[model samples]
Target: MSSPEHKQKIWKMIKDIKVGMLVTLDNGVPRARPMHLVQDEYDGTLWFFTRRSAEKVFETAGDQDVCLSFSDQEEGVYVSLSGKADLTDDRELIEKYWNPFIAAWFHDGKDDPDVALLEIKVQMGEHWKAKESKTFQLYEIAKANVKKDATPNLGENEKFGG
Candidate 1:
């Protein structure tokens, strides 16, 4: 409906943004992969079901900082969340979200010793619009020709008639 309402919905979508792309660094670059995940409403924690032996799991083994992104087709919106990812070899959760399809990956079994879960806690995020009919080029154009201005630091204009 309105701009604020749209933004609100984008924020709320985190609750249903089932799958998010996890971006990690290999050798000081970027790598993107998709993952099905659950979301925490109050504190914005993203839960993902994955295998402990997966490449992603290994990448985060030494690093906790990461980026989680979620988007949907219903609306032209997307959210890129930057946060820390904690890897746990928890067997219980591994069996919880396991399905028959996953048997292909874990020959050892769904509750195999290598299966695990990745818990990502979001810190701060940026939301953007993605249109199917037309690419999101508005921000790109404005951003390209954008002008920079310097402003006074905070509290500079906070003197209350003293």
Candidate 2:
């Protein structure tokens, strides 16, 4: 279990950057695809809309362990999350996350048989955030290069959860 504060911190980092690359093992090979994160709050779980017949769904059914990678280059923030994924057709959950954008895929809307929820119960996550401006970061790198014995201060790196 993760603390509420930790979940909030993760949510704040990812809220603006809503898309993530979800990776799952396929026949012992890593397969990855972009997924749009659907959520209103963070509770140690991430949700995405997926078709019931989607390859990711099938992959998760075989191996629940998954990884999600999120990045915002402009903000200099990157996060990697590991979790267990499962597919569900629960009506309430489907309705809760349904949006007009999702209709583009599920033409039949929330009631569509193909519409399903991909729930990821996050177990661990690591985030790297750069607090300094890019210009300053560049200067730091140059200074480090001149010194030869120093390393650039890029930012803070934190690991949370199990």
Candidate 1 residue 7 C-alpha distance from true site, Å:
13
Clashes of each: 0, 0
lDDT of 2 by residue, 40-123 (tens): 899999999999999899899999999999999999999999999989999998888888888888887789788899999999
lDDT minimum window of 10 residues, candidate 2: 100-109
The pairs that clash in candidate 1 are none
The C-alpha stretches of model 1 lying farther than 4 A from their native spots are: 1-11, 15-17, 38-42, 99-107, 129-162
RMSD to native for every prediction?
9.3, 1.0
Q: Could you give me the TM-score of model 1 versus the true structure?
A: 0.63
lDDT of 2: 0.92
Clashing residue pairs found in predicted model 2? none
In TM-score terms, candidate 2 sits at 0.96
Q: TM-scores of all models?
A: 0.63, 0.96
Off by over 4 Å in 2: none
In angstroms, how far off is 145's CA in candidate 2?
1.6
Worst 10 residues of 1 by lDDT: 153-162
